[model samples]
Target: MKRFALIFLFTFLLSPKIYSQRCGGGILTFNIYTLNGEDIKEFDYEIFPVSKELLQKNLYEKVVNEQNMNNSDYPLFKSVETSGRIIGKVFVDQIIDNNNPKLNAKLQELLDTSAITQKGTITSTLLFSTRENQSFPIVLKISNGDREVYILGNYFGNCDREASLVWGDKVLKLE
Candidate 1:
């Protein structure tokens, strides 16, 4: 069942011409910066979901095959490439290490079998924008020389069934 699900998800994500945003809203990818008057990077992002795929079995009966799904599914994001110059000091960062003993133990506690979970691990992303003249947002998680930056907010929604990113208080509805 898990194998079927992984394949279903991969095919949907790798396909082109996917719906560009969540069910009702669109994606917001903007520039990120540091506190010392520097633009860190501009991220290209997207959130979207699967178009319901109908299937046929041995008997040729129509089958609604929803893969390993939860109420809130993760978004299918593809980074856009641009030749525009990034005018800022390069920031060195590290991906969260999965092998750390504490994180390893925490991973188990965070994962749930019955429902899709992301409490312990970095599973979701939030986007934010500030009109103030400040260069950086409020939160930056730096570990092992890597800084994890995100829009800090709490949200609850279904991603296992659709492609979406909560991104602060607003629920971006990808089609």
Candidate 2:
């Protein structure tokens, strides 16, 4: 009994540190806007957290190993600490006459459903933008406390004028 209790306690103590490698458990808000800087839509999402190191590895593989952009050391290939984590905010390209509550509710419903399909504890989102040429047309930056990685890819490929839900590496187009 004593050995079993000790083992259990040890495992419990180390579990969180072991699992701190990925980010999840945060409600991310995406505020959509038009080119003219008018906010049109906003929604929240909860993506199942993935290991930051794993994500960075996957991204590096996607960009360099798979895409064959190995001529030089790609910037995103840097290592993510075991405590790697990220927060998200999204924006879209569209215009609306007004912010409609009914439409917003519908969009929220869609996001809820989408989150149910994928599945953290982060609060308060930040929103900002950079020169179009400096960033991807649709950018999702995952900033670990130490490093910030701008995920490069068309996660919004077919979701133009529509909503997109990113569950880990899977991108779902919500029409």
Candidate 3:
């Protein structure tokens, strides 16, 4: 009985750390961005907290890492951080609109959702964007069965009037 108890205790203690969270295919701990800087104040984009579980199941459109960002050594990123334990990123982009108030409200809503919905697998997620002069956030968070997707901005691509192709207020306007 003593030996069995010791084994059970050891396993219980070891499991959380081992399974708490991890990236898939060595893609853990990375970031994405729109402004191409190291901090949030300089960025014009929002972040998406990706899940390691999504990576494990091979459900992401892109996968990046700290090494990749550092290796490329791009100078314009505004802010960068890991989405979670997996190989995903939450990068600040240039589409943020500082001149609009309604945009602010939508952003607050999106931030609220991202903060509350993050759980295991992260199978579904939302990315947020806002224009400086707009009245509403172009994208919204919704259930798409199993995968989460950003539902605003450009339905096909980054809309210049809605979402800046470049994440900075100074980026060249897409013509």
Candidate 4:
């Protein structure tokens, strides 16, 4: 009885840490827009929680293995850590407009079927520019799902070219 109780306690204690080692959770929707407020890209991303194990793996793959550097060398890859433990695998969706009749119809149908309300909601905006010299901003709004929201934005600054959003001492950049 004593051994069984010890094993059970140990297992329970370690379960959360073990499971949180990789990304897995809910879907995050990111709506990307031009600086002029034109919606250009919409993506639904699978959110994952970042752990120390994940950080080590990413550093090894991108830095040590890919760049052929020693572990003691400066990191060649960057990692974003959020106050929350969720990262997303971004999946691009087809661009559509609110003015599009077909899309409007579909949206109305969804609204009719779903009992969605924006009571407890959080929104994060990330502004960035692409290699094409196009400047844009993305708005990420999360509601009625996970308790925490994670969003990262990266881009060169228009004025200084070194400005970045700092959250909890972590610099967020577009992946």
Best by lDDT: 2
The residue-by-residue lDDT of candidate 2 on 3-120, one tens digit each, is: 9999999999887655332322222233222334433233332322223234335444444566644433443321111111222322111211124565445434433543432112
lDDT of 4 at 157: 11
Question: Which window of ten consecutive residues has the lowest lDDT sum in model 2?
Answer: 78-87
Residue 123 error, candidate 4, Å: 3.8
Residue-level lDDT for 29 in candidate 1: 26
The C-alpha stretches of model 2 lying farther than 4 A from their native spots are 1-34, 65-73, 77-175
- Per residue, candidate 3 scores C-alpha lDDT tens digits across 40-129 of 232122333322233223322234444554342332121111121111113212223344565455445645533432222222222423
Could you tell me the TM-score of candidate 4? 0.22
Tens-digit lDDT track of model 4 for 19-59:
32222222222232223343323323221222223344543
Residue 25 of model 2 has an lDDT of 24
Model 1, span 108-151: residue lDDT tens:
33223223233222323333221222111111231112332222
Question: Which of 1 and 4 is ahead in TM-score?
Answer: 4
Q: In candidate 4, how many Å is residue 133 off?
A: 35
Model 3: lDDT to the true structure:
0.30
Q: Let me know the TM-score candidate 2 reaches against the reference structure.
A: 0.22
lDDT per model vs. reference: 0.26, 0.31, 0.30, 0.30
